[model samples]
Target: MEVQYRSQFPVCSFRLTFAVCVCVRACARAQVCAGAECWSVHSNHTSQPSVCGHDDDAFKYCAYTITYMLLFPIAILSNTGALVVFFWKCWHRSSAFSVVMMNLALSDACFSLTLPLRLAYYFNRGIWYFPDWLCRACVYGFYLNLYTSIFFLTVLSMLRWVAVMQPLRPQVEPVRMARVCVGVWLFVGVASVPFLLNGVTQR
Candidate 1:
């Protein structure tokens, strides 16, 4: 009876080990199947609707298109006409006021030239296919013009105030005004250096 019991113990141990291995394999297969199903469902459901997405929808369709298209030609023509008049008719005046006005016109014209590229970007739904350097230059020129325009406008106002208040004072020398303009250009150029560097590194 003891020999028969000992023989039966070995069979029981083998059966228990086999059942555990089968259960582990079954659980692993079940987990794999579940993971595959979950991945498939997630892939089907999760996707971006569009590249640009909904944030820019209003601007892309309404504001950007309308404003850029409308203003492009108007800005270009007006600024160009101003510049032509300045260079052709008023170039010989040599007044500080005229010099500042010319710089203002030139800045406006440069800003206007960048508008067409911006218009094209808007037309393409904010996609930039141009060379990176050109895009950087456009952006740099835009900002430079913006700040310089503000600066020059402020100077012009100051000059106007002086002219009105101190009516008897002598006018600002052309050489001094030229030096001021050069300083402004240098300052704006230096300020824009960081922007150019950032553009080169970023996308």
Candidate 2:
């Protein structure tokens, strides 16, 4: 029985590999039907669905378009409220934690402001009507926001842990925390060079 299974295994593996290869080839040259037009997508290099098509059904791309649409308004409102509250509290009684939270809200709010630009590509149904330079900036900002959020969240976690572990110790000054936030933004911006040098691409 074991020998029989071993003999069939290679055949099963070959069939699976062949199926995947066929799917990849088909997807590489797939032509999407969009109303009165059709376009062939030869390759998709970006994480976003930089695909070929213009249709009312474009937002059918559940991954990016719909997600961005939902994210835009919610992020804007929530972050704005957070920013206002943080600013008011920090103004009256500043602390390292509040300073960090303020910066985080500011970062998210700024990023949310760019959501419209991000959605422009999707709302137009996978087409980039924005200027190439603007496209590159948006792309850079996407990555910058991602890393900045991660870094800020990490800093917040560490600060909380420090507070818990050493409740009696003097809290770090808000001034220094603000400086750290500045340094984080600078480092993230420097690290994420705009893709304009490579030329913004659309499939």
Candidate 3:
């Protein structure tokens, strides 16, 4: 009886181990199925599992299309509207208000011009097909415009404060406003000189 029991113990243990393995496999399959269903319901955009360091052209295009289409239209419409308003106000009644508005509009327009190149860059994964000088110049010009816009806004606020507080004093005249705008632009250009010297082929 002892010999018979010892012989049968190994068979019993093997059967128990097999049963546990089967149960675990079944549970794993069920969990996988449940996860897939949950994700399917939650996500509208379907994508393959990402492979690390893989340059997926399809995913790149999907992202690029969404970003470019949305941003380009908004930039165009908003900047164009601003430009029209600036021109209208400046032509009829040029003041510190008009100067700041015009400067802001110019900055937006200048920044808008770079969107195409930026969109192109996304499509090509940071590759630059445009001229090196032009790209650097664009970057330089964008920053210059931004800083100039900020400077004008600050100046505009100061002028408005002075005019409101001291009504007897003369307001910011057109000639003086023009001079300040020109000075801002000139300083911006000089500040951006480093970009022109650096060129565009920055890695």
TM-score per model over all chains: 0.68, 0.67, 0.62
* Highest-scoring model, TM-score: 1
Clashing pairs in 2: none
Q: What range of 10 consecutive residues in model 1 has the weakest lDDT sum?
A: 5-14
State which candidate, 1 or 3, has the greater lDDT: 1
Better of 2 and 3 by TM-score: 2
Give per-candidate clash totals.
0, 0, 0
Cα displacement (angstroms), candidate 2, residue 118, comes to 2.3
Question: Per-residue lDDT of 71-174 in model 1, one digit per residue for the tens?
Answer: 66777777777777656635566677767777778887787788778877777776787888888888898788878887887888878777777777788887
Q: How many backbone clashes does candidate 1 have?
A: 0
Question: Quick one: ranking by lDDT, best first?
Answer: 2, 1, 3
What TM-score does model 1 achieve against the real structure? 0.68
Candidate 3: C-alpha RMSD after superposition:
26.8
Model 2 over residues 33-92: C-alpha lDDT tens digits? 434333344557434334454442442433355556766777777777888887897999
